[model samples]
Target: MRRLVLTSLLLAIVVIGLGAYTRLTHAGLGCPDWPTCYGLIDVPETSIQIAAAEQAFPERHVEPAKAWNEMIHRYFAGSLGLLIAVIAFVSIKLRFSKSSKVRYPIFLPLCILGIVTFQAALGMWTVTLKLMPIVVMGHLLGGFTTLCLLFLLYLRINARRINTQGEKLAESQLKKYSSYALIGITILTAQIALGGWTSSNYAAMSCVELPICQGDWLSDLSFEQSFDLIPPNQESYEFGHLAHNERVTIHVSHRFGAIITGAFLAWLAITIFLKAKTPSIKNTATILLSLLVIQISLGVSNIWFSLPLKVAVAHNLVAAGLMLSLIALTYKLRQNSEESLYE
Candidate 1:
């Protein structure tokens, strides 16, 4: 079970990296459609082949770079799907048969499977529709949500089977900490969503100066243009688009959100340090704080250097990693309290 958990965690991390690669390389349209690349199971091989396919659908404007990026992401995603399916299936086989009480073990993974499938579909639509911001944000959120569910499943599967000899009741106060962690997770998730929105909508460069969007110290910004549902282009929907409004709109929000998330994480870290004597809980807070600092650095760098692909992708990967770390931390907290209760 420990091995399984470790494997799942590694696979999830790989998925995060691949996702970053897809965006950094601007390959969201590499495959051009979900579950398939250029209407094939795998990406096309030659320039002629790509040209022929592009000729078939000239309006969609398929580019080789984007196609490969999208296709590779899908390939990795497909691999993850197969892996999780195996995990869920084997879990069912091992933990349940005729009268096992572990009926819910399969439920969480199954839900993840279903959601990933939907997310795969959304990925296709995101490209075909020419990178709609809302859909892309939805896809990003779905991907992170999938990560959380997988971690939960991994934790549940690795739960130690202990013989309780007149176990005492667990402290209900543990639930309070769980609630606090839940709040942190919620806030972090929202920040991730905004990050995706800022990325998909090309809002990252909206405020290049940073800390102060639009080169001002807290200007009265107009989200009317900032919140445009469509992906901002070099033309159309003018007015501070890329040259002015773009950096002003996105950088500030993204930076502010990171600070908020980091602040909450800091508070959580202090709480754990003071009250959570368990090694696992304390280590979780430490990991959480470490990731928070890294994430903040990535965000600022993305702006300072003008949103390079590598930096942007690293930013996204770190966000996903941060989420995974939090999930593990949450489960570790649960494990600590459970052991204390049952001890």
Candidate 2:
């Protein structure tokens, strides 16, 4: 089980990295279709084959590198699916075999089983739907959420510094913090979706300042143009044309959200530092502050440098890390408080 958990985490890490790679290579629409590249399961190999496929879609040309990048992402995702399947199988095997992990109260595997299925479907839709900004963002969040949940479970099962119950102070504030964390997760996920949308549409460079978009504290952009689901030009989106106005909209929203999120975290961290006794809480707060600063710095760098691939990817990666860190902190703070009180 330990091995399985470790492998799953690694697989997820690789997939996340691959996803970024696909974005950097501009291969989100490389395959130009889902479950197949140019309508074939495996990517086309030779120019003749590529031409034959391109001939089929005379209007669309499949760049070899772009298709490969997209296909590689799918392969990694497929690999992650295999790990999840194994986890589900072992969970059932452990369930019926009278394992020691299954004591008076059994841990549930059904939730994970359900989530894996949903994630697979969502993954398919991310491509089939031609990387719809909203769906892609949802899928990205779902991926991290899966990883964090698995990590928490692994910590509990391995007894790696995770307590099943709370301390006195942990108990008194459990419910309050739980709600706060949930809210944070919700907001953070939406912000990430906006971030992904901005990147997918090539809009990260649309605005170039922090605490403002286009020189305003509040991003002033045409949401109606930018957020339109369909391309404003009435062209096929897979041809790689997205709503530029929509892209601009996403850029502005994400930038402002980061400012708001960073401000919120600064306040949240100070509050936790003052009100919570756990050193872990203090540490989480500190780490979050650092991440907030790093994220903003990267965001600015992305623009000043004209959306350099490396910095853009780093900015995306940092957002993911921040989201997970907040989730972990929320879980620890709220649950620990509850146990402290209950005990």
For 1-343, candidate 2 gives per-residue lDDT tens digits of: 7678778877777777778878766677787677788888878879888888888767668788888988888888887777777776776676567654442112434455566668878877776676666566667767776776666555444432245433232435434666766777777777777776676566776666544556542445566656655444423344235444545567777777877777777777667667776666667767877887898898788878777878877776787778767876776655542222211
**Candidate 1 displacement at residue 288 in angstroms:** 0.9
Worst 10 residues of 2 by lDDT: 334-343
Per-residue lDDT value at 213 in model 1:
59
Query: How high is the lDDT of residue 88 in model 2?
Result: 69
Cα displacement (angstroms), candidate 1, residue 311, comes to 2.6
TM-score of 2: 0.81
Clashing pairs in 1: 30-66, 30-67, 34-124, 205-247, 206-246, 206-247, 206-248, 207-247, 207-248, 240-245
Give the per-residue lDDT of model 1 (tens digit) for 55-120.
Answer: 765655666666776776777777887777776677668566677555436667678779888887
Error of 2 at 114 (Å): 3.3
Give the Cα-based TM-score of candidate 1 against the true structure: 0.83
- Residue 258 of candidate 1: its Cα lDDT? 79
